[model samples]
Target: MRKLALIILVAVTSQTTWADAVSDLKNYLSSTQSLQANFKQTVTSQQGKIQNSSGTLSIQRPGLFRWIYQKPFEQLIIADGKQVWLYDPDLKQATVKAMGKALESSPAALLAGNNQFERNYTLRPLPSREGIDWLEATPKQADQSFNSVKLGFSQGQLMQMELHDNFGQTTRIYFSALKINPKIDASQFRFTPPKDADVIRE
Candidate 1:
C-alpha cells in the first residue's frame, strides 16, 4: 500500500509542473490567433463498434465555431459565441444552448472562448497513443465534467482531442489540413431552426 501511494503521488505532482508541460503547450498556443481544419470523428459506444465520419471545423477568437459533418451523415454544431445550435438532419431535431452555458467548459473554450488554458489545466504528454504527442489537461477549479482532457497536436496544429468521461467513453476528435486564422464569416455561427424541429433550451 505504501509503495502504491508513493507512485500515485509522484504522478499527480508532475502534472502541474510548469517548466516541463503546462508552459510548453501554452508557448505553442501563444503564437496562433485563429484556426480552421477538417476532421474525422470516430465514436464508439460502451458496447458498440467504431463509427466514422468526416467534417470541417472552423474557429475564431472570442467564441465562434462551425462544425459541418459531411460524411456518414449530415450534422451541424455551430456556436456563434453567444448561442449553440446542434442540428441533426436524420433525426430532424435541433438542440440549442447559449454559449458559455452549455458544453460544461469544453476545450474549444481555449481556442475561441474566453477561458485561459494555463489557469484551468496542466499539460503532459500522454503515453497511450504511438506516433502522436498529447497534452493532458486538468481543470484548476471545480465544476468540470471529465477528470482530464487530452489534446493531440501534430506538425504544430491542433489535430486531435479526446475527452474521457467518468463512465469510460472517450469522445475522440481528429483534425487535418488546418488553416490558421482564415477569413471566416460571422454568419456561420448564426442559427435558424428548421420548422417543426424540437428546440430544447437549457
Candidate 2:
C-alpha cells in the first residue's frame, strides 16, 4: 500500500538523521583539544524558580577546565587535572578536592575528560531545532547525579547543554562565541587561594 510505504520511508529517514547527529558529535569531540566560550546558564529549581548566571569557560582535553562566573556573583571553579578548586570570593573560602572524586557525576567531566562517550553513555539524537543538531546522552551509571544530558551543536560547534538532575532541577547552558582548539596557557588552569581566604581541603 502507498500509505504503508510512506510510513516506512519516514521512519528510515528519521533513523538516518539520528545516526548522523551522533557521528557528528563524536567527530567534533575527537578533533577538539581546547575550547573557549562565553556561556549563559539558567537553573530551574523543582519549585519552578529560575536563576540566571553568565560566565566564561575554557577547557583543555585530559581534564583541565576553568569556569568563571561573573554575573550576579563571582565564583571560580578550576580543574588542574589532579585537583579541583572551588573559590567563593564573597565568602572568602576555597575548597579543594581531588579531581577524580569531585568530577564523578559532573557534566564537566564528560566534556573535558578523555573518556569514550559510547562506553559511558547511551547516545541518541533528538530532532533538530533552531539550526542546531541535538543529541541526548544518558549515563550508564544508574547512580549518577543527572538523569539525562542533552548537547546541541551548530555547524559542528558545541552551542548548548541541558541537564536534568535526580532532584528535579534542570540546568541549561548556552555557549556563544566558541573558539575551538584555541591557544590556552597552561597557567590558566591553576588556582591559588587568596592570602586572606580560608582553604579547606576535601
Candidate 3:
C-alpha cells in the first residue's frame, strides 16, 4: 500500500511540474512584445558536419524581425510585416517571400509571430535539464522544414532553442543579453536591397 501511494504521489508531482513549465512559457509569450539579443548558432548535420555562427537579433511581435549574421559570412534576414527578405552581402543577392509563407511552421513564427501558438503547434513540457526548463513544440502542419523545436528557459527567460530539421540537421541557438520589451526602431525591421544587388522574388 505504501509503495502504491508513493508512486501515485510521484506521478502527481511530475504532472504539476510539467504544467508549471508550460505556464511559464505562456506568460513569457504574452508579456514579451519586443526583444533584442545576441545569439550564437551551431548546426550539426547527420554526417557530423558542424558549423558555428554568431549574430544579433531583434524582434517586434506580430511579424517584424531582423536577424543578422556577422561571423564567417554576413547575412541578413528581415521581416517587414508584409515581406521577408534574405540578403547575402557576399553574393550580392536578395530573396523576397511573403511573410506568411516564409514564417509558416518556422522558428521565427514562434518568436515574432502573432500569439497563435496553439493553432500552429502542439506544445508540451520537457524534463528540466542543465538548470533550464524545456518545452517541445511540434508543428501541426504536414509540410515543414523542421521536425520539432525545443525551447529552454531559465527563470522564465528564454535561454536556448534547438530546431531539428527535416534535412537531418540540428540547429541550436543560445541567446544572451536579452532585452525584453525594449524600444526598437521601426527601421530595424525594414530592408531594402542594394541597387546593384540581384533581387529574387518568391
Candidate 4:
C-alpha cells in the first residue's frame, strides 16, 4: 500500500527537467487555451520515512484546479488560479482565501501567460521513455515551499507528476483515465460557499 501510494503520487505530479529543443512543452501548452487531467498522489515525510495519504488532482489550465483527497479522510480544495477554497467534509468547514496564492509555485502557473517561467527556475529535459517525456524544474525563488517539481507528458498531454519538498519529503501523483478538450460545464471552476460553512477570508 505504501508503495502504491508513493507511485501514484509520483505518476500524477512527476516533473524533473526538460530539453528546450523544440520548445517541447511550450508548443503543447500553447496549443490549448485550457486543459484538464486526472492525478494520483503520495506524500512522504520525515525525510522519506513515512507515507502520507493518497489523493487525486483535477487541473484546468490558466488557474483553475481541484485536489481531492480520497484516503484517510475526504477533503476538497479548489483554486480558481487567483484564490483558494478548501473544504473538509469531516470538519464541515471551508477556508476561503480572501487573497494571495497559497501554493505560489504551483506548476499550473506555467499555464498562465508565458513570462519566461525559467526566470525563477532552471529547466531540464529527461530522456523519453514509455512514450512519455519528462522535465524536472528547480525553482530559484526562495519563498516557495518545495525544493523541486517534476512533470511527465505523454504525447503532449500531461500524465504524471512528483514534488519533493525541502525536507526531503516527496509527493508523487499519477494521472489516469485522462480526458482533454471535453465539454466542461460552467460550474466546474466556480466555488460557492456551502451553507453553514465557515468562510475565513485571509
Best by lDDT: 3
Q: Tell me the spans in candidate 1 whose CA falls farther than 4 Å from its real position.
A: 1-24, 101-104, 127-131, 141-143
Q: What's the TM-score of every candidate structure?
A: 0.78, 0.92, 0.93, 0.74
Residue-level lDDT of model 2, residues 36-83, one tens digit each, is 999999999999999999999999986999999999999999999999
Error of 4 at 197 (Å): 2.2
Weakest 10 consecutive residues of candidate 1 by summed lDDT: 15-24
Give the best candidate by TM-score: 3
Segments of candidate 4 deviating more than 4 angstroms: 1-23, 47-57, 98-104, 111-116, 127-131
lDDT of 2: 0.87
Q: Model 2, which residues run further than 4 Å from truth?
A: 1-6, 101-105
The candidates, ranked best first by TM-score, are 3, 2, 1, 4
* TM-score (C-alpha, index-matched) for candidate 3: 0.93
Instruction: Compose the digit string of candidate 4's lDDT tens values, residues 1-202.
Output: 9999998876554443244322556775566555555556777776556555656555565566677787878888887756778888878788887325435455656543234566656877666667778787887776677777787777666767778877778878787776655555556667887798877776
Clashes of each: 1, 0, 0, 36
Q: Model 3, range 73-151, lDDT digits (tens) per residue?
A: 9999999999999999999999999976548567888889877787889987787787788889999986988899998
Ranking by lDDT: 3, 2, 1, 4
